[model samples]
Target: MLLTAIAPMTAEAAGEPFDDEAFLFEPKWDGGRLLLHKQGERCEIYTRSGRIVTEKLPELREALADLPVRSVLLDGEGIVLRGGRPVFDDWAYRLRISQAAKIRTARQTHPVVFAAFDVLCTDRPHLEEPLTQRKARLGELLQRGGGILTPTVSVEAQGRRLYELTAAQELEGIVAKRKTSLYIPGRRSSDWIKIKHPRLIDTVILGCRSEPFELVVGLQFRTVKNKPVGRVSKGLTVEDRDRFLQAARELRVRQEGGVQWIEPRLCCRISYRDRSEMHQLEDTEFLAFLWDKQPEECVWPYT
Candidate 1:
């Protein structure tokens, strides 16, 4: 079915996933978020950005076509597994494969699977229905041992354990949803909270300090007022450390306390704890230099 407007609902980040009887928790799959729609032998796929990608992943469309429902809209994540863990790096290749022959070859090498999370529109419209009810309907619609798409396995009142397990398994994290929450399309509501493991963030490099033995780098988020929100001095491979030092030197703007303040031109991705009231990212550890993310995109929550 051709949907003129089927914008998927968005989730807001939470400080951490909490265990509550009023919520259901599921592992937040790390990959592209795709909305699958099937109508009377017709199946189509859409990215969260509203791009129509039906022909991109033929396996996904074929899998959805096998469903028994006449009309259904399923929200899911398209993940490619590597060593039993979802990896977005491989998913990038899947998304970039455009040629029909190349797509088939890529699918074989790195197959993508769907983990359905919600049922937006089924036999009847269910968007207005509370998430608790929608989840029940979703389970009924896609039972276990189904095709390529499987409903997201969720836990009730066990968020703390779930988050720990997800982290230990080197997975992304868990998404906690209020049982009574409705699926409000295109809305980033607090009712559905995203509690990612290893809280990864993209920040702009503001400066660096030469500590007694190591180099401590300062990073910030917002560009309007570039205030250092965190410090990262360790957790880098030898190659990364060299690359960082070279970038800092080239982008140097000033010097203070043996610290070379650099222009906010380079961006880096890192894992950090929640920001303190004083606006500092505590326990910040470097993950990788993010050349893909522009410095202008580094906007912290201003919390």
Candidate 2:
């Protein structure tokens, strides 16, 4: 039961992928990290932040409870698949359902699966064991789960190949984990590195939202024309936020419906996974302010 509350281990970001015989590469699923604790017939699922989410995934809970092991603690992702690929938006939607009836209905219509990547405990703890051993144990323990529960597939010494496969499939990315590394709960360690397929774009700051502090960014066209792409706030540090707000004070043009319009003089770099059908940026994260670049230089085509 204590393992259920344990913070999951985190991975650092790697700029690029490399071939390493000592590393095991696995798909970086775009879903929420979850810990599953099952003892006897009792099963509970917890998010990475330690919030209990068992009520939101009844089908997954039941499937995990039926595992052949006596008691097991699993580290994995909670994903909702569409066309055999994990969709974070759908998985996120499932997490937001609170009403009991709605959750039950969603479980039937929009089911989520637990893709177990690591095994922390089986009858006893195995945190100090090396990752290669833990992975072998994980595969053995998850041999008989239904479709609702599955093991994450991985390749040894083929990080580049796996990364290429993920890119071709348009998956999130690949995780390169050292085979000899031990799981360190709650720590972001270099032993496990995540290589994501993110695209970078430079955009002009069009405005700012007062509440929750988000920057409205757009791609510059002609000197006077702009096309709004999306809003970004994810990667801003406190200092960066303060600096932007201070700069905005002098550039304020007008306030329209809770948004403070600026003079579109500042430019910032953004990292995102892709663009939506409507051309809005998806999974947008603010990288940094482009001081050397002009707003007019952040133009359309993003090249």
Candidate 3:
């Protein structure tokens, strides 16, 4: 069946397979995946899971109004530029807008750029073709693009090199793909892989909660070893938070200030970009929480 929803694959390989093999790779964007449908006089935006986001972005709808194709389904991400840098948080604001004033505020203050990467459907059906061919056709279809369409490239080695550089430069990571692999929807096959950033650090779990939320473990850590650190709340998703809450009854610890002290045995590795004031604030708004330091798991890139 033709794939719709996309699943990101983890990168376990440190280097490419030694063979001069078949693969095409591109920079794994930090933004979310957006599937667009421009059919005749109608336009709709869908997530990989088929969640419609048509009304969320008026600016995007207006920008693509000039496209030639009456009907087109394209895959891409909405990115925002802040301080001359493309910030994922700026794009995320568009997703979080719930009021007209908020939407207008986003449009006027935080503009978005639709970076189209693939053409799922054109006036002519092209979804059945191999990814290599479809990607080429996508390039041809979006030819009249300015900087709005950030086309993906199919350079495996170059992608790997870029991945290495991104690690050094503290950028996110890259996604690599087998040139011949079919586009499998919501499947994380060997065809696609991600090499994420590698930077590890140990942190202390100061406290955890049970009622306020689930497995929400509050953390406090010193940037430098042996230095006094402030409270840095993080380390749990909504789902995990619930689970942790249930589990907290069996794993209680002493409370200190806003922190709950737990066994400092579960230090996680994390990754993050160099502290940019804009991206930091942007990330906080995107995550709905302030992030003082990168996650511990980010340091140990190899899971």
State how far residue 164 of model 1 sits from its true place (Å). Answer: 0.4
Per-residue lDDT of 140-253 in model 1, one digit per residue for the tens? Answer: 877742557888899998999999999998777889888988888889898888887666777887777655323343444334456667778657667876787876777777
TM-score of 1: 0.70
- Flag clash pairs in model 1: none
- Per-residue lDDT for 1-303 in model 3, tens only? 122333322333433322225766666555667776776777666765576666787766765555677777777766676664456656666787869888888887887777675676776766557778878878876776555655765565466577666556544566676666665445557666665554333333334534443122223323332222222234446765454345445556677654455543333322232222122211110122223444343221111
C-alpha displacement of 188 in model 1, angstroms? 0.7
TM-scores for every candidate against the unseen true structure: 0.70, 0.74, 0.63
Better of 2 and 3 by lDDT: 2
Model 2 residue 153 CA deviation (Å) reads 0.7
lDDT of 2: 0.86
Clashes of 1: 0
> What would the per-residue lDDT of candidate 2 be over residues 1-303, giving only the tens digit for each residue?
443598989998877899999999999997889999988878899999899999899988888888988789999999988888887777877988899999988887779998899998888889999999999998888888887788899999998899899988878899999999998899999999988889788999999886788899988654446678899989988898899988878999999988899998899999986565345886789999987778878776521
Off by over 4 Å in 3: 1-21, 199-204, 207-303
